[model samples]
Target: MSLRLNCDLGESFGSWKMGLDEAVMPHIDQANIACGFHAGDPLVMQKTLTLAKQNNVTVGAHPGYPDLVGFGRRSIKASAAEIKAMLQYQIAAMDGMAASQGLTLEYVKPHGAMYNDMMANAEVRSAIMQGIAEYHRPLVLMLQSTPQAEEHLAEAEQAGISLWFEIFADRCYDDDGKLLARTKPGAVHSKEKMLAQVKQLQEQGTVTTVSGHTLNLRADTLCVHGDNMDGVNAIQEIRELIS
Candidate 1:
């Protein structure tokens, strides 16, 4: 069995810095680049795409809400039309950067709060799906696997878009197959625990949630958060364990 590892990169904006993206790149298979909405600018996006090309990493767009201050971690009130337009703009921007680098943008993954919101909000999910459908290009949707995720996946599948199920390496899970709240104690696992989880997901096809319930999961891809200090170390350990 094989699994793809992904990370959110290209998050720095202007003079601000976030993540040790260069250090993490060598260890990850796919790079989900931020598209100037939540945490990136054109310069950062271009630079990141170039690095991905040099490293031979798969590139995908990471679009989020227009909340730069919250880094798209805060939910905003917006209509479906507005949200769809915002997504379209972000996707187009990344597509332009990818084109310049002679690389095709492979997929789309909503970032932070937008990601969690779409899992349960049908309106948000529909808007995102519709935006992708209108693109007229083959693009995969990277998302978590859960009961709430089914509706979005179904919509994407029906629209002929590919779906990649993602599991977090450094995050805890609830019994219901949802990620544990970040604010909760022990919500994020240590590098050793993360490596074990990767092995369990890849070999046994299951993960034991925080509530002590084991659930079957497809480990198509694993994610490492860019901003976490332990992310690089965790990825290295995961690569060694999986190798």
Candidate 2:
């Protein structure tokens, strides 16, 4: 499949605000919207859905652990059953809200620590896959594209769910095909480097890792973040490049 651009949105709380969703929504093809577990409320989600619909962007559920203070970046320990329940709860919430707006969630992409844990822990990954499979309607599961693409695909097949392998356009990857920790230096790329990476992915279908290794990633979609003005501007540039 051709690579598509997606962004996380609807992260604003009642009084506080987060992300330049209004500015970034136009540039993206898919919107991974927060489902209130981490950073969004019903009203904010409704507004985001309306914005996405206005832009003709596809919607995906962005579910995370209930960690508002840490923005869902902090890991939470829970059983596989608990993880499955959490996934379903969030998906149901988003699905109902989207239905209200005459919209439908096209996929599920876990946020923050839940995302990382799903990538690293087999148990967590299985639970998430199972949850998606058991949902009332079919929904694709969007996750990082790693060297273990075949393995992940097999797991998805076993769970009876489709997969969309995603790549980060502005983040550094380790040799293991995992994103570098945010605390680490150079975990995020500057605008020039970010554009360069996207160019390489377009031209060569590979990325250079932090350890100076060439890693081939099967990218179905490219993920962009618009947490600031710079990020919003960068998304516009990236949209042009990818288009």
Candidate 3:
């Protein structure tokens, strides 16, 4: 069995560098590049695309709400129309950069809070689907594995878009297949625990949640946060495990 590994990169803006993009690129199969909404400028985006191309990694657009201060981790209030428009704008911007480099945008993954909100918000989910569909129906939507995620996937599939189910290796989930809230005590696991969790997910198609319950999951791709303090170490361990 094989699984794809993806990482959020190109989040650095201006003088502020974020993520071990250079170090982590070699270990990942796909690179979700920030599209200037949450974090990234034109130069950073271009550089990132080039790096991905050099590394032979698939390029994807990572769009988020206009909340750079919060690193796109804060939920913002917006109507469906606004959400759709913003998404289109972000994707177009990234697509332009990718085009200049002669690299195709392979997928779209909502970043941070925008990603979490869409997991359950029908309006937001539809708006996201509409935005992606406006670009190209074949673009893959990368999403977490959950009941709500399944709903979003079905909607995207109905709209003629492909879906890529993702599982987080650095985050915790509940038995119901929902990601644990960040505010929770055990929301994120340690490096060792994370490795073990990923092993189970990769080998058994299931994860044992903090609540002591198991949930079935389909992990087409695994995600590792680039912003974590131990992000580099986590990536190294995951690569060793998957290899």
Query: How much lDDT does each candidate structure score?
Result: 0.86, 0.93, 0.87
| Model 1 bad stretches (over 4 Å) | 147-152
Q: Highest lDDT, which number?
A: 2
Residue clash pairs of candidate 3: none
Task: Give per-candidate clash totals.
Answer: 0, 0, 0
Q: Tell me how far candidate 3 lies from the true structure as C-alpha RMSD in angstroms.
A: 1.6
TM-score of 2: 0.97
Model 1 scores worst on lDDT over the 10 consecutive residues at 145-154
Best by TM-score: 2
Candidate 1 C-alpha error for residue 110, in Å: 0.6
Error of 3 at 11 (Å): 0.8
**TM-score for each of the candidates:** 0.95, 0.97, 0.94
Candidates in order: C-alpha RMSD to true structure:
1.5, 1.1, 1.6
Tens-place lDDT digits, model 1, residues 1-243: 688889999999999999998888888899999998899998999999999998999999999999999999999878888888998899989988899889999999999988988886878887778778787687888888775556656688776777888999888899888889889988989777787888888789888899788888766788977566577777888877667
Worst 10 residues of 2 by lDDT: 1-10
